[model samples]
Target chain A: MTIHQTPSRLVTIADVAREAGVGESTVSRVLRGQGSFSKRAGERVLEAADRLGYVPNRLAGSLAGNADSAGSQLVGVVIPSLTNIVFPDLLRGLTGALDGAGFQSVVGVSDYDPDREEALVAGLLSWRPAALVLTGLEHTELTVTRLRAAGIRIVEMIDTDGPGLDIAVGFSNRAVGHASARHLIGRGYRRIAYVGHDLGRDLRAAKRLAGFEAALAESGLALHARELVGDRSSAASGRAALEALMARVPDTDAVYFSNDDMALGGYFACLGRGWAVPERLALFGCHALDITEAMPQPLSTMRTPRLAIGRAAAEALSAGSPPGTIDLGFELSEGATA
Target chain B: MTIHQTPSRLVTIADVAREAGVGESTVSRVLRGQGSFSKRAGERVLEAADRLGYVPNRLAGSLAGNADSAGSQLVGVVIPSLTNIVFPDLLRGLTGALDGAGFQSVVGVSDYDPDREEALVAGLLSWRPAALVLTGLEHTELTVTRLRAAGIRIVEMIDTDGPGLDIAVGFSNRAVGHASARHLIGRGYRRIAYVGHDLGRDLRAAKRLAGFEAALAESGLALHARELVGDRSSAASGRAALEALMARVPDTDAVYFSNDDMALGGYFACLGRGWAVPERLALFGCHALDITEAMPQPLSTMRTPRLAIGRAAAEALSAGSPPGTIDLGFELSEGATA
Candidate 1:
């Protein structure tokens, strides 16, 4: 296909040097605008390069050890999913931080698949990024092997529960779940139910559920019922799942959702059924999204340091700090929902 | 800084060839897994390369005219913002399409700044991507010059109100606004106001507003009031903007928002104030988001072909189609809100 067609013979620095009647080093300095060179030589080189349609190959320059080149200004970021607002918030924080530091993020979405992540890792590594930032600590064996071999800084963001390959920046999902469960229990939500999306792909969500169940055991109370939607988390799926759960277990006192998207749906379901929140049913969620906060009765949820985690990850990479975990922690919002 | 430190003496293919006791061509074929080579020779090359920690330089391979290499499997995508779900939805569709074709998307967010977009275009182009996908048709002169000089396929997505650079895949924002205004007018609402975010940066929103105003002129009626939030569009901003607009002009019978995010915020504001929707103040928005639909009264808005635009953009690039526009038209969802 033409998509794979090699670009028509690109104009190189040598060609520019010849056309400008200058040395190759002069042409290089003029194009990079780095090392000092004669102004007249620079003008001629630029003119020649522009005339020949020469676009500098930063990839080759990076390989040639141009430390201050634009090639080294890129940070490869691999995230799980973009449909969820949490991931986008993470990206916003990251790009914001990176922008001020003159670093650009080249992002890849793996859709929560380890195989795809491995392939993406291999593909991004081929670009020779200055650093690589991954969503979670968990990765395939091959992905880890490639990263180790690549010899670049690796920052794992959004979860700090497990040991990281290089650097980890985030709060504990397990802790957020534990705190959320404790808050519900303290409010006398004994027959609480749980509604979530597929926990198989989302390990962080699975960890939160584990901690939630553990907290329930501590209170000698367990979920009265649970509904797991087979699809990705969304308001529509959350509404349907909550409906299915309430149909089977009508006495559920409270419902805990995987995240704000699902929780918003569950809240909508309750609103549609004329169920009084916190009296007929209490609904809670993770990630204190703005939309959730703007709800008529704000949702009771845990506010994970999403933006902070992203900023911290970029800062850690830029700072070249020692490899370790940086737990920014989370906060519990006691809204009117619970 | 150590961040730019050249990786310590990377092992080259020549080293692997010497260690594996094979020719350089044999080592290359083994590493690429293309062309013919003995199985034993392949195993030896792989073992030697792995032991020496050799990662193939696809960038060099690309320059060397390897058409089927991973270097050519990259498609650079530059979006405006990720905080808005619209951008992420576009990415979701793009990655989904690119993934099946064994291509990975390297994304850059411009934060709605033309200067940032120009820099991002230069940065991404340095990687020699097979195709470059941009958000809108508008670009700085330098950005246009670079794209023209790059000699690669360029796909401009999301708005088709003007001329495209190479390929355009989206619907007319002006048409969407005209239809939306007509819909509200047909519903017997005249005292309509508009609430939006910084239209200076979001040109598509500006086009919609222009079209909305044009349609109103045809009906010999203009906006009763308008609230333009100086910040980016969000649910919180939408809520505050609506509150401010309603306070300034209480007689406003209907309000149109930039998108569902802002409209959802206005919906919440109405709920908080106990304003009966469609009876006291009707609300309409764009991008019929799922959360908007789950509200007590589904939001009456236009459903722009967001995901389809992303898919079509990728398809156009992959199919190596000729330079033109592919307008995947939008839909008008007549939810109960308006």
Candidate 2:
């Protein structure tokens, strides 16, 4: 087991300098190719460095090692949360392409906070990754500056409505919301309510709500009630929010959840309270998650192409394609719920 | 318009060397705090380096960084999949406790492969993470050696039967499997079949299957048929596996799935086929996921204390406690399924 293993200590400029019998500064200058040095001296230093197995530590300079490394190959992707199956499914597609091309991936989570996202972006950028793949375009001003200035490729995924930084790979949240509202309105459900998490922070959700309300307005009807929860969206929060929404607005005929997970929770709440779904309270949701389809009567939801989006983003990066938006499209599933 | 600007050209190590009127190697030595250097020289080098805002490139000599940063109130956790929701729920508790104690976390995904996990651990070790919090302890020999020589702390999660590398935090997988089998057997369900994915790779699932088979043997009932899929346990895979299993073994009265995701899939399959669950054929699964309980007929399964396990592991690391095992018990939910 005890093979002749080298000490694992880094071969620094000092080692090269010592071996070459020259000033350490000389080695640094020669390595950087900045200052003038005698060719013989440079040759001696290089030979000594090669013999000592000296590898330059690029960490000393932020940009020294990152640029021109086979292409913009290492992409730093920042998502809101991995707990959501959609994100991972997206990654599965993204990695399938990125891996084959020898591109490495570094990931960061913002926990759905714009401020945390900005900080995470800063940390990720320190690596000088080839490209930045962020969840949504709604980032802090500081994040925008750093990302723009970094001058690497930028791709904002999962939502495309407003102006993009460089590239956008997703459908319009506003369009999705409008479609959901139109679909519900067309079904003769007048007294409609909206149950969602913090939309102010999640601009994508806000856009969807705007589109939904716009469709409702066109139909000469307004939202019966809207309940917005603070912080991350989840089943428990969805259930609690729905309970509060229904309790406060008893006359609402239909409820549209922000996402399927929340709607699933709302469904459970209905089951717990001994209320018949669809007949008593029609429920609609987005993201046709497997469980949503698998539930006893199935859940009526809009299926977003999450994995396709991810795969497309990776493909764009791979091909070094010009920055633009791509709409993968969505589908509305009419299940037993609505 | 430039309230703050990041220049196109970064401040590199050579700038610090020239500013300090010292060799570049002297600046590196001071920043790294490695190899003997005069204190006066180091102070000058460090002062110049600080002014220049140099963050070292970790890619070069990353291993040394791991060796230096070990046991510094930072834990690196590598899990297989966050989509499982089990891992995130687990991380929620672990981070909650550790965050309070001034400990930070860095995470990596191994994608349920021993080889990927080995690379991730090596990467994490280079950062000198305080404690290595991994999903399971079934590691490659090289991974074991690197971990053993890591000289910090270790915590293996989610199963306890295997040999603990350092500290193990989980319940016995075998017990859960046996209990599930016994519960089904007690219900007079013979001609039972098991359906799961990648038992050969998923050590935990394999252990459960072994235990389930043992219990079946004790009750004079063996698996009527077993089907294994080659992938991580997923809803779609589970449903497909179940359909295949059912088609082959039409005489089977009950089926056991690897986890709730796959079980939900199987349940969905039953729904699609118009087979009355628990009447025409019983169903059983593990990990009492919240969605599973929301179904009309609650999932009859065991709720592993994933969060509790994570919390206990973090607590052990923060308290600087010695290596040992922590068993957070599992809850068996007796529903109409089996």
Candidate 3:
């Protein structure tokens, strides 16, 4: 059965009025409840409208036809994924601020795809939003062009290491990585392995890994072995990667995962194999997630200020004053695992 | 200094023609490239259009003027949260199917808030969507009334125990909870505690917890202790709750968390306090998330069919099928912890 059908000819108030043998003004008034109509005339117009399946145009609310031109009414946010709690925390701050200003924010997920980011930017700009809030300073050449041409405020979130396309709100991922590595080295872990997902997709993770390796290199100790997964990092993948790394490099005393998910996997793998954490093998991660803290052993990790980043992004965008950087720093949560 | 000003009025084709010193038909021809116009006239029309900031109306596109009528080209989806991987997985399926049908899906987050869901439904219905897909069977009295009156196809997802307000497509959360409890009990875990957040808000989590209690009660084993947080369940809250529960109920050998986040928290709490998981305490959760599998010892839990639920809901709405239930079962993954 046909769920819906399109009329052969467009039905309008004029058509309804003509069919009901009334003026267009009369039909419009009756439909909008703006003016009175004779009961007989109203019934005839209503019957004609029902027969034609005519729906009144509310394109003009109290705001009239001005709806489409309001640039500040729509805020466009482009992020990598919502699966990670960090993004949600960031949005909590952004939405809290923007909605209060009567601005409705729409989101697009690129899944760490630069081409997709470019495409999303083009689509979001078509709405002519007041601001574009994106994750990271890294962008494809096309994305940069469209964002610039869109002539809207841009806020790059979750990293403050490099020159931003516009305003930047986040911590230095490199610093986070360096701090993590330094913390591990300070704990007297000489040999360490790295387990992570595709750094190509998550540039922030790559920066963190680079800084981690740099700190280790300073002590004449490089990564013992790095086990990588070419997919989105999760607890399951982290566990599998850690298991594979242990079998390949059993001498490694500690392992630093790309994120908490991977670290949790490494932790579970240790539990399954009856390996004593910190004694036989140490495990460390980024993102001081609540789960990490709750694990039988709290995960040794860094807590990026996700909510702060989001709030700052909205504040910076709304200020419409200047383009600069705001470093929302990270905190190290030294749990029992490391 | 106004960051947000009331939007300016729209300039119609008539205004553009008036500014360009041309007839409306001639301006339309020049703008749409549908009919012939002099080069001078075309240039004049272009300049006037640019200066006036006139945008072509898409309301007259392939599916125009259906905004207030039934059979609108819109599909509305309401989900709990994307921060969890579940909703995104569901969207992957829904988008893959609906995008091909020229039906644009607009999403709203209820945040498990029934009042918010009710408001969103009213807003979405104003667009007169062809179909409305919402999460869960449980809805507010006002929500049920408005939806019933909306005269649109409705599909409630991720539940199957109760009667559908329309179409229902999901598995039984209670069954998943029961299975998890039975699995832990079979492993000789007699002293089991529960770690959860506001069950009143998240009905699915509440159902799981209820089923778990029912199963445990059958074995003459009631929950030893429960750490209940009157907020959304988070990993950090879960970790804290587990720690608190362990302190109060030292004899508790296992814990059934409301979901994976709580379970992960419980796992971390054990880690922080130097408790041996599975040996001293067993941790079980639901949603057999990817992170759970990645941890050193995989988390023993059930994996809900989130993608299937989403796909089924979209398909049912699209097909205009009668209201019924679709039971996409959950999976029990047994890891070393349980």
Candidate 4:
């Protein structure tokens, strides 16, 4: 009934050779599917390998200078949470682009924890991937050190506000925040408030908020109220935060959310409470998700080039491009909500 | 401004030893952080390794029988697509469970293409992972052959209508369809239509549709009308398909969508058209996504144990349990939408 017994000892090519009644050289050629071998010998070798569960050592093959093999075909990618649709969109673009170039991605999710990211980096690096693609510019000191030591192509994607360790492809978060604030202010929304998830871990959100506050200050105004949820951003949290914010600051006219998921929740809160959007309250969000666009009243948000950034990251790695920032700018949609 | 010239030659331990002015064994000891080495020797080795970009070959390490290292700690996963929230939810559960057991997931997205899945399987096997986790029970012949030959723990997740290659963890998709039909029928609704995406590639969705049709036939009724989109399921597609269905079959009293994404779109379409839900026309969907639950009127749908399936799959692999199907079961929610 045992599904699989963890092999007590690793299966070897020699074992397959012995079982197939072939020489080790013939067994190796057949298993690797390289060089010439008789059709009968190939069948016997495969059957023996299958029976013994002898997995071919691709690492050994790579070490033998097989440039087109497993090691060179892998690109290790590390990202934050998958709950946010943005990360998945990024992955779609990356995988789509990487697939075309005959490479596969090995992914790790860090859940916004620096220590987890550092460990994941070490683990992926040990595989000797052709390149490493990371979510953002920030990382633990150890992560930075290890990436530097790995000597692989390093691509820090979805942020370009600072210097990258290697290649950086994304729009500036500060600029996105600044534009959101300006759009709201241009429409004469003075009593603007904020609803966001924990900013301590999501540094990008923090950066965006900073830009928003700076723009507001430039206009001689400040946030009337704010609700900072201690958990990750979600529609449920956004709904609760909006309800709480409304109770504390009833006169707040406009609300800027950290991202579209939060804004969708805020929109739902207004719908449930019978608050007229843009008339009684205005809402703004970042990362123009498809759901947001399809809302009864499309959410007013900045459409960051998420998929494009992912594609660019992959393309840069495949082409072996120079290391620098590629700023694919954002677009502001003045949706009916705001 | 060359960021990195794809290392013309891989730096080896001997190279590090030469640069560090130390023995290769000492460099290896320092790099692996095993055995004993003087502090000065360790420092020199690290500096040299960093300067030379000497990546450790974990494949060789595993071949050398480092049981706790890379090969054993990896579990390769292949899923259909990431665009669906369901897949991400499954991954969240998987990574959350596997992380605790000191295992990391290497993921591949097959886009519901059996050929792509086959290639992905071969690619992942080269890494010599401890286990292989695949979605659904269906696979190409070569994929099945390779998985069986790989001799690793295999966990087929999120569908359990058929036999698994090894461990299977999920509810029956057919059962979900049947229950959904029964629920709608119990509500005394008839003249139901269906809106779905391409079923040719999504075998599980096809299974559910088959069950739904069977249940309908048992009740002496069949789909009053149906709309099958050639593209993948999405809210936008759902919305568009709903409009098309209503236009084509105005008398249809209820609609069953493939999944929550499509249903959400239908909901938005209804709102846009001022149609009262469940009164004018009822709606139902599969996979109870959070967005569906958080809607103004929650969606009536079947909630498959997606996360539980993922957790169970990981647990089975880690625990090395018996080879059998584990029906985690599903839940049906009759919300206001229906």
Best by TM-score: 1
What C-alpha lDDT, on a 0 to 100 scale, does residue B193 get in candidate 1? 99
Tens digit per residue, CA lDDT, model 3, A267-289 = 87887799998899999999887
- TM-score versus the correct structure, for each prediction: 0.91, 0.75, 0.76, 0.86
Give me the runs in candidate 1 sitting further than 4 Å from their true place.
A1-11, A15-22, A30-54, A66-73, B1-11, B30-54, B66-72
The fraction of reference interface contacts (C-alpha pairs within 8 A across chains A and B) present in each candidate is 0.54, 0.17, 0.33, 0.46
Model 1 whole-model lDDT (C-alpha atoms): 0.87
For model 2, residues A1-338, the per-residue Cα lDDT tens digits are: 55423345445689999999899889988876778999987998999977865545333332333444322235677877756667766766675566556555666666788987887687666555678789887888878877766667888898988788888998888889999999999889999999998887667778888989999999998999999899456676678888899899988889998888889888878876777889899999988887677676788888999888988988888788897888788888888898
**Native RMSD of candidate 4 (Å):** 5.2
TM-score of chain B of each: 0.89, 0.81, 0.81, 0.84
- B1-338 in candidate 4: lDDT tens per residue? 23644455567789999999999999988987999999999999999998876767765666566543235567889999989889988888898799788676778899999999998888888777889999999998878877866667899999999999989999999999888888888888899899999999888888998889889999999999999999898888899999999999999999999999999889989988989998999999999988777677889999888889889989998898999999999998877888
Candidate 3 B-chain TM-score: 0.81
Individual DockQ of the candidates?
0.44, 0.20, 0.23, 0.36
Could you give candidate 2's per-residue lDDT for residues B22-138 as a string of tens digits?
987887788778898998999888888666655443333333345343423346778776667777777667766765565556566677889988977876664455688898869
Clashing pairs in 4: none
For residues B43-149, could you state the per-residue lDDT of candidate 3 as single tens digits? 99999988765644333321333444454555777877656556666765675466445465556667788987886676565445678889889888867766665
How far out, in Å, is residue B118 in model 4?
A: 1.1
* lDDT of all predictions: 0.87, 0.78, 0.77, 0.87
Per lDDT, what order, best first?
1, 4, 2, 3
- The local lDDT score (0 to 100) that residue A43 gets in candidate 1 is 92
Kindly report which residue pairs in candidate 1 clash with one another.
none
